[model samples]
Target: MKQIILYAIFVIFFTWNPAFGFLSGPIAGRTGAPDDICGTKSCNDPPVCHGSYNINSGPASFFITAPSSYVLGETIDVTVSFSNTGSGLHGFQLTALDASNKRVGIFQSKDNTVQTEAYLNEYAAHTTVGTARTSWTVQWTAPLANVTYPVIFYAAGNQADGEGTPEDDYIYNTAAVIIQPTSTPTPAVTDGECDAETIQLSQNLLELQKGESREIVITVKEENDCVAGGVSIKATIKKGKKRISLFPESGTTDEIGQIAFTITAKKKTGKATVVFNADGIKSKLKVTITSK
Candidate 1:
């Protein structure tokens, strides 16, 4: 009699409604690994964990878009998106790994559903509130450049039935993107009879933690990485420098037509503008200082 009761309890456990159970709906990281990153491995067809509803032949689609090549140390944007065959429940995991499988750069979510994880991985799923839309989007800042080979991005998606069964849901779809390093630039024609080209900082957004120092790179490129030769550049803090300092405010570009400077901030400054003056043309980089 005791054995019969124990068996009955076990049956109830598996039959419990998933909508109210531990995993209720698309918990971002709970999906087991090896399968979570479905790029190289196969996810179980009838997903042993998540339930299945309809056996759909069409696979969910994952997409990544980024520049074919990027300048060294340049911060650029990368985008990822996913969609499936009209499923109310969806979840996704995406990450970028270098040649050695090391996570690179920082990821910031553009939507509430998306969240970044350690090791350059990011996830998005239908919250408990859920959504009728079948697609999600996210943005990633490329790692501080100079990555010679290529950075590969891998993503996986699930088209769940929302019924909480592993039998009818479609669990696996994968995509990848490769970004290569920008090649050396060949000097292009002068800009409309100018003796020398203008210069600007390679990055427009400089984010720093309070009481921290970072080196900023200034470059004069007429076209792409082709550095303009013999250009003079000067940097000045237009505002909020009382809490920050820049070294060698005035300098001439090297053979590559670039100047490197250091910025040290003593406290949080909501925003500071670093103005680059070259050939009478001025450009600015916004320095966003944070306390944390």
Candidate 2:
């Protein structure tokens, strides 16, 4: 009887009303591994976390339009959109990186380049596609144009990809643009850009009594290991220098967008702030641990 009850609870908890990108990847396979990552085993069907491909044969499409060239100090706008053509819901984030995959510019939020409208869609029964419509627009003073830049659309890599889940999934694309000054030099943007994408932080936070420790799966794209962009990621806790709590063994931009990390809350802790920053954006979340 106890085992039966426990199994029932597990079923209910493990199977939430999941209906989004997390469910849109490749076919079924118990492996849970994703394809196209740096180097890791691949799942049978790849448990969704589908990479630049789709499993449910979902209809997914995306595009971006921007000026081929701009003058220095001129505000540049980029528009991007995608449609999920299957029952599986979809979400995406965008990021502009230099040729080196190093994140570019300053956005308001430090989280993934999450979509503002909760990047979700619904797939009808017996249907292979759902649709999501959105455009990414941002203005920036032109940079050196001749230096080709890469615009990347970030879909959460396989949870094995790097860090964070679909809720925290950040999808972005990279492209190159040129800057031409109109006979006048523009001042450098030293204070950082004022653009920010608000991401719903991971929903798990716990309280640990003295000596009680909990390991958390921290998903952060900037902390990802396998992808090519080599995004310089740094972390801090309690406003001072702190050792990184969690990390992935290897790889980047897998089918699932996740970088697994562990965090342990020790004694003398009541409430603490775990702050993460990357690509000029910052996300600060609260973690509380009560004393016994």
Candidate 3:
């Protein structure tokens, strides 16, 4: 049966060689190569970029999942999925670019079929060792703290009937993600008052040169004369504007009911008063600032 043998050989060769027979799909960076080649008109004669070949519409979709807002200099998880309507083979190309179309952060993948291309895009397809799965994951790190603009991730997917041709294939389904910059919060400033029920000052007056600094200490006690450690105390320059400066103007008492603060004179010659208060108890310190 020579004729039968020839038919079997033909079938075997066509079945194995997708380029000649029933083998339709991507060959890693074949169809859509990302923003570089795909979107450019010079890559192909008619430019088969994403959305270029959509005549054979299907329910297949390509999408990416990521945070709506990203913190600068942070790593985040990004996932890309290409789900086909029917049981056809699917492939995808994904890339994250800034306003200048340059790659952002780093890309890492656990699947061997998926790989980085042109240092900017990632390409994934159904390999012989892997099945035509619909989902894949990738890791991306945000840009440095100096980056202020948003980043965009673009992706394109193709679903083919494994026929080794684009005749019945769905060209591309697109997806994108726009990552905005996270907002920064301002620090809150707080002021303090005294506690007369259980607090005393180590000094009632502070003498300092125009450019000198001195430490003022305070003592806290309970109603029964017990050391009130951890009592909150606040010091304020009630009578001085630019004459003096206080270091850590507010703090809590230590284990020995002692809280110390540093005061410095900012003027050549002036007089000022500092009031320390905690839980309604208050004390005063008269500061005399003079030239050296």
Ranking by TM-score: 3, 1, 2
lDDT of 2: 0.30
Can you write out model 1's per-residue Cα lDDT over 22-139, one digit (the tens) per residue?
2323334332222233322323343344333221133665455667556555555555455546766655555554433455555666656555543234443333332344555556
Q: Which stretches of candidate 3 lie over 4 Å from their true place?
A: 1-35, 42-56, 117-131, 145-148, 183-292
How well is each residue in 71-189 modelled by candidate 2, as lDDT tens digits? 54355655544444322233322334332333334322212333222312110000112112233343344444432222221221121122323222222221222222343332222
Q: State the lDDT of candidate 3 residue by residue for 1-292, as single tens digits.
A: 0000000000111113344332322333232222344342333222122222331245676567788667766767777676646744665555565534455766665566555543343433333332266666766777775432235565545555565433454544333434345543212222322223555543454555567565555667555444566678988989985899888879987654566677877866778988888877887878766553
True-vs-predicted CA distance for residue 32, candidate 1, Å: 11
Best by TM-score: 3
Model 3 lDDT on a 0 to 1 scale? 0.51
Q: What are the lDDT scores of the predictions, listed in order?
A: 0.49, 0.30, 0.51
Clashes of each: 11, 62, 14
Better of 2 and 3 by TM-score: 3
> What residue runs in model 2 are displaced by over 4 Å at the alpha carbon?
1-45, 51-58, 83-88, 108-132, 139-292
